[model samples]
Target: MRTPIKRDDLESARSDLLATAVGWFKREQDVVGIFLGGSVAAGSADAYSDIDLRIVVQPEHHLHYVERRREIPTQWPGFLFNEWLPNTQHCVSHFQPFGKIDIFYYDAAKLTPSPWYRLQIRILHDPRGIVTDLVKRSEELPFLVGESDVDLSISKGLAAAHETYRRAKRGELFYAQTLLDELRHHVMQADDWLHDRTPETTVMAKFDNRASGEVLSSLAMSYCPCLDEAILAALSSLARAYRNQVLALHEKFQLSRPLRNDVAALDMVA
Candidate 1:
């Protein structure tokens, strides 16, 4: 059985695990390169920050490595539990003495250039200098989503929010909240696009723009358990923010404005 971990011992535990990982990577022949990113590479890691690793392997050995990914934590010390994320390429492992590591395995030949590739990264092992070349190429490429995609996201969020309001009016509180969650997700994605940030698994608190962060915080706090109150609150917050985003898009590009029909459906006095 795995021993219980104390919160106070998490940092030291993670440090030891990282050292073990670096050593293992250096010795593994199939592993072509290893890069460290996320909060640690970004220099913003706190006691609560989890370790993130990008493992690049030989193209021919990609499937072999991925299939055996579960064995990774066992090779290290203090592994407690692990959860595979929806993406087969990613996994999160928890360790004894309290800590988590998020690992992403990639085929060196199949790796694509994106914002993540350019983020603060430390190449731990690159015998052929493949990662160095990729990093250099990533810097020359612009990481951006098209304006049309941003417009579509805003429209989807508004439509979902409207449906959520309708569901709440019909007394389907659970389903309404479910749709509200989707609306929130789309809104956050739109925010990411506005700032030229990758929308994937973005943490709102890490947003560089203070106004965007405040908007997200306000929308989160607007959620309520009461059905009618929640519906109105969610719709109001979404509509307000959606309008601002739409206006910003129009100002920057020639995008069409989002319709305000959803806000009109809400009964403000109720």
Candidate 2:
């Protein structure tokens, strides 16, 4: 059996691993710049936080690093597995000793200005000052989502929740649960968008202390071993959370409230 990792040990391992990565990047001639992003850079890192590194290379050497991305992690200790995202610009590597690293490769010439570049970042190596220039350019860019976009997302969530109820009533338990999960995802995304934050898969992290605890409680009630109980409980909890979210949005942003009929439909299921 694998031993549980202590928090202090995990933090130390991450620190050491990051130092090793800095050394490796500095030695590579093709790597023009490197910056740290994500939780660590944001000063919110904990034992569970993974290392996020942005490697900026010359355009001519971009594909060279991409082709050999799999071998890159092997240079670090405790390499286990790596998965390349569909975007082909990032890879996630899991290590033995309780560490994961998210590596993003950006071609210096192709880099675009965005709000993400404005976020807290730590420059580890930048011989040509390319990453610094990118950060400065991104600071002037605006990132905004219209109220209509948030409204549409909530509407979609309601429709999906109704479909989930229908599936449950028809004894399609598996699909019903699946659709219910999707409904939760939509709600979480809407909430994040409403608050002018990025929609992340880590749902609880997006909410405040009280709301996060409530969401966790609702999730617990939604999952059950028995199909019928699971369906009923999941739909009921989803409807409650969905309604609360919509109401909050309407009150805060003066967005149109959900249709009465749709709210009634969800209410019926609960």
Model 1 spans with C-alpha error above 4 angstroms: 1-8, 85-87, 192-205, 212-217, 256-270
For the record, the alpha-carbon RMSD of candidate 2 to the native fold, in angstroms, is 3.7
Best of the candidates, lDDT: 2
TM-score of every prediction relative to native = 0.79, 0.81
What clash pairs does model 1 have? none
Which 10 consecutive residues of model 1 have the lowest summed lDDT?
Answer: 261-270
Expressed as tens digits, the lDDT of each residue in 126-237 for candidate 2 is 8888888889989876766667877777778877788887887788888887888888777666556545565222222435442355565665566655386677777887
The per-residue C-alpha lDDT of model 1 at residue 259 equals 41
Instruction: Report the poorest 10 consecutive residues by lDDT, candidate 2.
Output: 199-208
lDDT of each: 0.73, 0.77
